[model samples]
Target chain A: MRKMTKIDIITRPGKLEELKEAMYAIGVTGMTVSQVFGCGLQKGHTEVYRGQEYAINLLPKIKIEIVVCEVPVEAVLEAAKKACRTGKIGDGKIFVYPIENAIRIRTGEEGDIAIMDPEDVEK
Target chain B: MRKMTKIDIITRPGKLEELKEAMYAIGVTGMTVSQVFGCGLQKGHTEVYRGQEYAINLLPKIKIEIVVCEVPVEAVLEAAKKACRTGKIGDGKIFVYPIENAIRIRTGEEGDIAIMDPEDVEK
Candidate 1:
């Protein structure tokens, strides 16, 4: 019955590795990363190919999602912000949510156990 | 203030279009799609490339995220589930979270307004 919070970090794709390393350093091993398209203050850019102009409305971004119960939410937020900081408009955004449950299909683990590394499980 | 809920659906990439159409039919337009990698009961596969064997433990997944305040959470959930249903192990998973707030960077709108379509905005 541990409480869990899910952190969604959307930022420049190039900064993913830095954020990953930072989170991992804090023992937050399990995460889901995705390539996304978003429109922020930076909006998008226009490109021409084969003499045809195309407007790309959504800019490319990366989303790192992690659900944790033991890790402090503030610590993870700081780590993500530190890694993603660029003092630019399109540095991206972070969203925090309260997760009700998590289930691991392989092992049928639930809650906090579902997101933990196998090594952390009892051998 | 309106209570907002964010739904995160992780499923096969191919099902994205179907889900989008379904949600749109229900007037759920604002969403974020991401290309992600995950491992469930499927557990990925092994491939041979140029006389080398590569084991991909994580399979490709598409995560569709939508934050809504007006749409009924159950309706959106049912639509996503119906569209993503395959009766297969990897058909996907749905994670729902409570969202505190949403902001639109372009106009500095917040809360429910941030998620509304411009067409839905007043003249």
Candidate 2:
């Protein structure tokens, strides 16, 4: 069983789909995105101009999370970087960590094979 | 300093706002909501037809997370139960764990004072 690497990504909502597809291109489709607020090394926040609430989230950011085998860690992360590039505040951040295991409830497959990207294995 | 307990909540998107208010009523703000897929003690999944994406999320679940002081843990959890009541499969589950410390990077306040609920501390 390969150790799964979880990526924490924050990018604009508009760029979310592109980022998701980029990960898919890297053979990582089983992923999750959450509307999240961040205030880490960057201190992501929102600002108000008019009384109207700008869903633009002065601190608007999307968290793209994917669990992938360690072998493809760098590829997946790099793909995300390229896809979610704004080179500015609110563009987001990516953090990686080890995922001990993953399981597919439908197929009853456990570990990497469960949520494994079919494309990566062939590469 | 009180230990922070993290709560993992899974409920319908429709019930999300209500749940948030419930947690807030219990003096828990500063939480995060994530769209999630679950198949835990209950196998949460989606059904598809017509090849059209249904945002209804047949297995839609919301994760309501709160960092709370130990003393009010029970109260917060109870508030959630009362508010998010479907008594159904997607109603979700709540798990609590200990948080050793919390820091408000902005205020430079460490431990309890940083993210402490003003209402809880007053009581």
Range of the 10 consecutive residues with the lowest summed lDDT in candidate 1 chain B: B40-49
lDDT of 2 by residue, A17-87 (tens): 67656765655645555665654342344433234433345454667656666438889878878997866
In candidate 2, stretches whose alpha carbon ends up further than 4 angstroms from where it belongs are A40-58, A117-123, B1-33, B37-123
- Kindly list the per-residue Cα lDDT of model 1 for residues B1-123, writing each as its tens digit: 799988887877889889989999998967898778753311243433345644432467788888888888778877877787765445555666787898889999998988888778754
Most DockQ-accurate candidate = 1
Determine which window of 10 residues in candidate 2 chain A has minimal summed lDDT: A100-109
User: In model 2, what lDDT does residue B47 have?
Assistant: 32
Q: List candidate 1 stretches off by more than 4 Å.
A: A42-57, B1-34, B39-59, B64-123
lDDT by residue (tens digit), candidate 1, A1-123: 788888989987788768877887776745777777776432365533345644653667787888878889999999888999988556778998889766543444556776666546554
Per-model lDDT: 0.73, 0.59
* TM-score for chain A, candidates 1 onward in order: 0.83, 0.75
TM-score of chain B of each: 0.83, 0.74
CA lDDT for candidate 2: 0.59
